[model samples]
Target: MKSLSVKLFCLLLVVLLTTPAVAEIVVEPEDITWTTDAGIVTFQIRFHNPDPTAWADEVSCTLYAQDFGVFLPNQNEIGTYDVPPIPPDSFFDVFMEIPFDQLPPPPEVHHPWDPMKVQPYCTPDDHWDGNVDLIWAGPGGAGTIDSHLGTLLVCPTYGASEIHVVTNCVINMTYTITGVCAGFTVQLVNEDYTAAPSPLAANWSGYIRVTADATVPIGTVCCFTVNFTCGGSTIPLILCAEACDCGPISNEDLDWGRVKSLYK
Candidate 1:
């Protein structure tokens, strides 16, 4: 996901370069890793404040699962947390989880081993399964300073101004899509319908297992194309994950109670 985050950051810089006074926020692991057991999935996000000047006074941070147009619950901001002052030249990690069962199942479910359902999205088999986005927010405003590809320091370059600007900074985000049967093939397709291989492990036509490593920064929209091949042919699926601020529960996102309820 390191590469993915950097790619997204560069794109954000070009798109939002006109925005005034944007603080640079860098995230590592553009995609989060997920592991599934039975019906449970757990994951972690590793982050650091490389710039002592920018993140010095960052009093709080928030994590969120953004909505991707669909009513599916996966898009909601699941967690928001507060933290103490972090020393300069230091790093921090936040652990979070997403329960597959917590969100409604896709419109259709095809067993990983089911060859008949493998080609549902091809030609006459177009499917409309919904997708969701993921994001995290901290004390820094939406802007970033220049640095190496994988450096941990994100030095602050600007300050907040009267401008209600939206700067989408790039950071690393990694996630593991687990619980699917093993030995199947998983591919990530973008909004443009282009497909790429998923880094997760799983079998064909049994369940969907995929891991995506991308460079994603905050404030950008990301669409995923998930494909699993069971009987030689490929089946296509789509999901979207966005980057944004997931402040405290009171920030008025999708629903904090529902997110916490699943943890119980």
Candidate 2:
């Protein structure tokens, strides 16, 4: 019995010594932020690894833009980034600014009345949808992961214009326009003679200024449209403006003083 037990223990020890240790590694997307200005779009994404012991010697990401069939040769690579070794269970953020020249120009489409308009909207299924390919390598081996980053909406920029407010109040309103790849201008059109400032260019801060006519009287509302023109394409936004004091609120209207307090 003792000789048999000794042989069995030797066999188990040999098997344990020959087996390689498996490293647990995982990469995940944390957040993605996008900004556009002057017909250019920029993207910043944060990623992290969950494995505590394995370290990646290199990490890379590839970005792809999905365009409907209206544009020829869709699925283009917008940007790429490579980083040095990333420690286990650490976070990394990468930024890429896509130039205007690399962006696909707006496609010419038939008027809204034409049946061909349906063709432009049909094929790509999701004009703004995109994909990101992530590759990472460790001392043990290399692996790849992919993620569908959701809709980006870069072509033919337009936004929902329905707004409610009190009449005769100088209320300030801001709008966020997405998928604006080319330089564009925003203007209030057919406002029924409503007093408003001239159109402003869509910049990094997606802000549009709209003012109500004080003389128009209280308890009154005006419905109008805002036009976003870029790359020979125009998107008319139907806006319903009413009287009310909603107070000024916008993504760009950040209180830097208050932000500094948090750090202090």
Q: Scored by Cα lDDT, where does model 1 land?
A: 0.32
Q: Where is the poorest 10-residue window by lDDT in model 2?
A: 255-264
- Model 1: residues >4 Å from true position, as ranges? 1-25, 28-31, 52-55, 59-62, 66-74, 104-138, 142-264
Per-residue lDDT of model 2, residues 175-257, tens digit only: 33343212322233222323243342232112222343334333344444434343454433333233332223233332211
TM-score of each: 0.33, 0.35
Relative to the true structure, candidate 1 reaches a TM of 0.33
Query: What shift in Å separates residue 241 of candidate 2 from its native position after superposition?
Result: 17
RMSD of each: 22.8, 18.5
List lDDT for all candidates, in order: 0.32, 0.38
Give the C-alpha miss distance for residue 135 in model 1, angstroms: 5.1
lDDT of 1 at 220: 40
